[model samples]
Target chain A: MIKNQFYVISLLVILSMILVACSGGDAGGTSESSGGSESEAVTLKFFHKWPEPEHMEFYEFAVQEYEKNHPNVTIEMEAVADEPYKDKIRVLMAANEVPDVYFSWAGEFSWKFARAGQALDITDAVMNTDWKDQVILSAVEPYKLDGKIYGVPMRINAKFMVYNKAMFEEYGISEPATWDEFLTACSTLKENGVVPLAFGDEFPWAASHYVGDFNAKLVGGDVRSADYLLTAPAEKLFTDPGYVEGLARFQTLVTAGCFNEGPNGISHSSARSSFIAGKAGMIYIELEEFVTVADGMGQDAFGFFQFPSGSGDEGDQKLLTGAPDGFMISASTEHPEEAMDFLKFITGPEMGKEYVKRLGIPSAAVGAVNDETALPIVVKGVESINTASGMALWLDTDINIKIVEVYLPGMQAILNGTKTPEELMQEVHDAAVQAQSELSQ
Target chain B: MKRKFLNQLTPYYFLLPSLILMSVFIYLPVVENFYYSLFRWSAIDTTLNYIGFENYTRIFTDDLVGLSLFNNTLYAVISVIFQVFIALVLAAMLEAHLVRPFFGTLFRNILFLPSVLAISVVGVTWQLIYRPDTGLINQVLRAVGLDTLTRTWLGEEGTAIYSIIAVSQWQWVGYCMILFIVAIQAIPEELFESARIDGANAVQQFFRITVPLVRETTLVMTTITVIGAFKVFDIIWVMTAGGPNHASEVLGNYLYRVAFRNDEMGYAAALATLLFVITFLLTFIQLWLGRTGKEN
Candidate 1:
């Protein structure tokens, strides 16, 4: 029995040795084969957040096209849904294993990765190449922090008030021209037993746009970011009285019964549905979503208007609250040039044109959108972006992530009447100061 | 003597691989999490910044943490009562009917249905039911002329946490019922027969005989329900996302937000360790009580 056991153990050891030998041989063979070739084989890992059926078409096709053009570079693509994409990127960043080319939102979101030395400072690649002239400068600026470019813009989006045209006509009012007109319109609608804003604070960012637009309009886009990013000196720390005023303006809307009943309980989709179904007069939603919402509601039901002009502060109120989504290359990538090439090829005018021509999303690559394929309402929305003052990135995207995390729930508390705006903003100010001190340390 | 010595080590040889795996994957991560709990860190940092006990101090001082712990405590207390006492009543009724009735398995299956369903699916389904505008609750209230009583079940602060608790009870009560049924079945018929002969009524026999006999099973269910209550994330995450400014936030949900959303891994680790210690002490106390109850 002991002899039999020895024989079995020897056999198992032989089998394991064979397996290891085969794996080693496989690696050796691949390197040898590539060594003989003129085109050095390099594999690039590409990660993106466009896993939806409709969205995947162009991206998959573009990857294929890029690979065909660059036989030396092989692109491996992994597309994930949005929330999980953001989450997995953080985990990857923690492990120091970020993908070579990955989706990034411009402004403070991308700045976090850049500050960590994860993202490549691709100023030369973005600015020196013909691609520099292709993307809009406003779309390009958010990716620039500390006078260095970290990413290239892929898509530009703005938040606009999409009002139900039928509701507006029936109420004998056009789109509001100023803050007072907007409040008057809301009060009139509420008195007539019509819900004015089909909005919910359940998705806090959806509610934050009111404060975001109001902040930009009141404090100006530049000062908003300075305070939001906590770049202000330690003594100042987002203490502008205008910050409180902007929040108070939002609270005023809640007090005026502008939103649907139990706004905190409902979801974004529910609010959008209510507006489309004519249960409410207006909704403030992202500009990119206009095409989808209008198509769903049948374009005749609604029309787009930018958030009304606020007269309370001495700033250019014409600026739209908006940001662009983009792509960045990892600093650790072995093939930085190849990754930059991929980013450029995908985010250039052709891809933007394809996006606009096929999907009707307004592209950051200027003049890429063909107005013919888009609905007239979508065309109108695009026209507004072209004519507008400066664009302010989304509040959550502009502010330090930790501060925004605190601010969102604070905003929700204010909207729900659990806390006053003064208290919430005070909490936000404290968090901002804490973040600033940490950075200083 | 040699053979006996070899045999003594055989069970350990069998357990070695799994024991190593458990130590590496489970125990190692737990140790690392504890170590990390001492520090402050952010997404941008290459390494943990050790602040030593500041996170724990924050948990004690932070109102959100207080609220979260309070919510979790309510969940544990409410869920255990429903899963143990109420389920026992249900198990008795169903087990009695199980012998003579045609609809016995059918009723049991209907009750057990929610347990079989995925928590996310159950959350989504309940979301529709709790929806204020066209939801079944408000619709029924309006139909019955009790419209004034209608309020947003999942949105309002007062109702949100309880609304989620109701979902938890609905899903788990049947699982506990099944356990009770098995324990009741295992009880010998002769004891009950003697109780009946002694002029004990149904309630008397149930209280004197069945209740005392199922103490161990009751303890098992209690432990399971209590631990499950503290660990609940998926249902609450999907249904409310600890929303409307954290009206429904529990410790587990708050830990997730602290870790992922705020990118405060150290603070999250601290919160997790706190939860682990609390769960451990509570479980030890429970098991101790169960043993003492048996001795008595």
Candidate 2:
């Protein structure tokens, strides 16, 4: 009887433990569902890679304003430095702890997230918004795969050359009008004891940006054809006359000792600093850098020009490259409606203009206006690109992700003389083909 | 029968908690990694499809993978041998002759200061020191009439990896040094006195007595250092980013570039699993050697 009673007691204990575990799990479920349904006050975490002080200040002001307009909703901003941002986001996603909203580039790789239903389908909601048509179509297109809009573009930047206008005039050098003229200018700057181009091959992509722009321009900024070519099976970028010509032009500048001494040693920020400090003659940088440069270099520091003409007149004058930067709602969000509301408030007209005004980069929204006094060069730079024949996406975004990891380093090898252009191109083609085949169904 | 069963089950019960923890944290993840290596998996992808060794095949065929492996192995072996040896020697010196407690403690703390700093801070600080034009190292070299020896340490392809290793060694030496010092101090004073009576010189005493006594400690430190070198990401990521045509590519950084930056989760998983296998084998070897040395 005693042993039987003991057995009964243990059985009861185990039953209670099971019941507790079940109850605990059910409570978690109930809270999530209740939170999703209720229209009560909520805080949505928004993660981004913009951790720079100036950029941080701008977003802080915009988000605060957003909160003021919507009393019930609060945006909790979690910003990480650019280098670690992607890894942080990946870890968060893998653990199912993704933020309500986060910044993502508009690309094939980012598009996969939306296609997999990881990104919220914001197509209908975005279309019904007050400033629905304000976003640039091209900037918005990259965010859409299979005709579903998953993100909103906030900033559109064009790739171009920024040089010190005062220094250029002082040295009696004009902005190059052709590829030949560009080389002459580089040599002239070099002979005059100024670094011709603040090229930082150490970053690799800095050099790739120039080559990407040059290639695009050489092909008449033929994005449509390039997109088609990208989708097709091609083994050789060198076989493309445009690519070879572009590479030759890039090598011409390198061979002339146009870049800083020990070009492979210079970093992107170092190059930026050198150019801003009036130490280097030219640098290839995104449009957003103009705001920081203008702020740091004071008002009358620099001027902008499209990458000097490549071959044909029309191609030379083309936009060359630019893209949008913005945030998207995570589809895994339990309270997606509330998340969209937060996004709507943050990306609204007032916030958009304020962001662009503070950002110094051009707004993708057509209705957004720039503060001229703060962003003279940026404004002029945008105007030049907008009036051009077309805009090309940066190489990282233009090509597949696998190519970016492989081809970029290979190109760097060419610059470092570890491999020739022909060898690097062949290797890049093989790697890309293999990656594409694996990615394909 | 019950007693026999209890005797057989005792060790298993004792091992249960640790076994459970290992399965949850280590073994399970390692299995998952191997599983992922054979699939098309991304953080964003809802559906994972099995692709069957494509990722591993790609790595074997790629030139970049070979280069990265070479760099990783070079970093691990070079840093481990040099760092452990130097740390052991310094610890012996401090414990043997540095009888002034205050000065010894101060020096030890000062040397360990770099290890305490954040990796990013250490990387940036050393980068400035290695800067070609306005860096203090180059400036000091010029001032001392050693201008010819001055070079862009972090910029040059030939010297960048070595320079980074030097910085890593400088930061971590103190950590190992303290460990060695503790191990050496625990050796009985009687053994040293007996050796002294036998007319053994200090150097001979160090080799014959101190070295053998601290063999286990040496093995543990060497293992840790090897693992630390294999997993080195932060300082190199911040400093050079495995660039200038990947002259400084290590397995960790290369895996990072593949996984996060490129969004090739499966390929990166394959690479990471390979790295884990390599580390596991090396650690097993270390443990085996340590046990053998201790037994002898």
Q: Pick the candidate with the highest DockQ.
A: 1
Error of 1 at B156 (Å): 2.4
lDDT tens string, model 2, A348-389?
666667777666667777656454423667777767766866
Per-model TM-score of chain B = 0.92, 0.89
Q: What digit string (tens of lDDT, one per residue) describes model 1 on residues A1-441? A: 574465456556655766786799789646633422337887888898988877888788888888899888788788898666767788788776689999988788899888888999998877777878888877788898888999988877888888888778887978888889999989888888888998866668776777888788777555666787777786677677777888888888888888887777788878888887778888888877887786788878788787784785755778888888889999988778788888888888878888776677777786776556566766677677778877777787678777887788778777767788788878888889888887777
RMSD of each: 3.4, 3.8
Residue A53 lDDT, candidate 2, scale 0-100: 92
- Candidate 1, residues B149-175, lDDT tens digits: the string is 998788877889999999999998988
Docking class of 1: acceptable
Candidate 1 off by > 4 Å: A1-38, A220-222, B1-10, B97-100, B193-199, B286-296
Model 2, position A71: C-alpha lDDT score: 73
**TM-score of model 2 (first chain only):** 0.86
**Candidate 1 chain B: worst 10 consecutive residues by lDDT?**
B95-104
Q: Residue B210, candidate 1: how far off, in angstroms?
A: 2.1
Alpha-carbon shift of residue B103 in model 2 (angstroms)? 5.6
